[model samples]
Target: MTPRRRRMVLVALIVLGVGSAAAFALTAFQDNLLYFYSPSDVTAGKAPTDRVFRVGGMVPEGSFSRASGSLEAHFILTDYAHEVKVSYTGVLPDLFREGQGVIARGRMGADGVFVAEEVLAKHDENYMPPEVAKTLKKQHEKPTNSGPLPTT
Candidate 1:
């Protein structure tokens, strides 16, 4: 082949290689991406069923329970408007407790439960994960009273 033709073919091959690599990297990134959702979002069917994602909310009082002889625990996560049941079969974080903000990472199970691979709790009494705080804020901002305010 002529030198010019050989050079053109090489350039085309290099471009193809780079394009293929980019596409592969993008696919990997997308597959590994984890999204955050509130319990309300999960209850509304907005969470992905086939991919790992995060659910954050308050663990309601009396909603947490541990198995008799196992590390497995079940709890309900709620954003005041909705709730999602979560199951985690491992030691929970030191700060994990009912009536506190928590976030769990996992995928939804066949039984509509969140099978958590990792569970995180708030760092302190005054601290809450940003996602959880945002969800709670949205929940509390909804007007509960439709009637106009009355003055004394």
Candidate 2:
């Protein structure tokens, strides 16, 4: 092949390779990225239904109703403006209970309930996970059914 023709082919191949790399990166993220939005954000129309995402909020007091020997339980996750009902049918975390901060990883069901595949509760008093502490502080600033949070 002529020198000029060979160089032109090499340049074209490099460009194609770069473009393919970028496209693959984007496609991988689109397929695997899992967003976690807060309950306030979800109520404010920030959560998308098409993709699986998470919702974090405070579990309202008296909102938890557990079935005997069954994992199915009903609860409410709320922000100040609105509340979302959740129905989870799995083992909850040890700290999971009423009047505590929780982050549920799942999608909103067609029936308007947040179907949680995983439920995370607030950690202990002094040794809370950084993420949970930050979220709890944000939720405590607002008032809803979950009232009178413990003071540090």
Candidate 3:
């Protein structure tokens, strides 16, 4: 082959290799991505029933309970509009408590309860996960009587 033709072939091969690598990386990342959902989403059947995902909301008052002789515990996570029952079989975080923001990672059982593999509690009263905050803001916002708010 001519020298210029050989150089062109090499460049095409390099581009193909880089494109394939990028596509593979993106597929792997998407496979491992975990999404956060609120109780309202779960109730609306937006959460996956077969794969693990996160559920975030407030641990409502009078919703936490522990079995007497086991690590099993139960609680209700609520977004005010809906609630989900969560069961966990491990020690909870020190900061976990009723009326606090929490995120639990797990899958939903056939009976519609969330079986948590891990539970994370907010570090402070004023702090909430950004996803949870955004969801709550959207849920609580009132429509303006005059007109829609101006977009920036």
Per-model TM against the reference: 0.92, 0.79, 0.85
Candidate 2: how large is its RMSD? 5.7
The most accurate candidate by lDDT is: 1
The models' CA-based lDDT, in order, is 0.96, 0.79, 0.92
Query: Which is better, 2 or 3, measured by TM-score?
Result: 3
Best by TM-score: 1
Tens digits of per-residue lDDT for model 2, 48-134? 877678777767788899878998988988754468888899888998877777878888888878888888887775554455456
lDDT string for model 1 (48-85, tens) is 99989999999999999996989999999999999999
Q: Please tell me which model should have the higher TM-score, number 1 or number 3.
A: 1
Model 3 shows how many backbone clashes? 0
What is the alpha-carbon lDDT of model 3 when measured against the actual structure? 0.92
lDDT of 3 by residue, 31-94 (tens): 8999899999999999999789999988989999997888999999988878999999999999
Compute the lDDT of residue 128 as modeled in candidate 2: 43
User: How many pairs collide in each candidate, listed in order?
Assistant: 0, 0, 0
Candidate with more favorable, higher lDDT: 2 or 3: 3
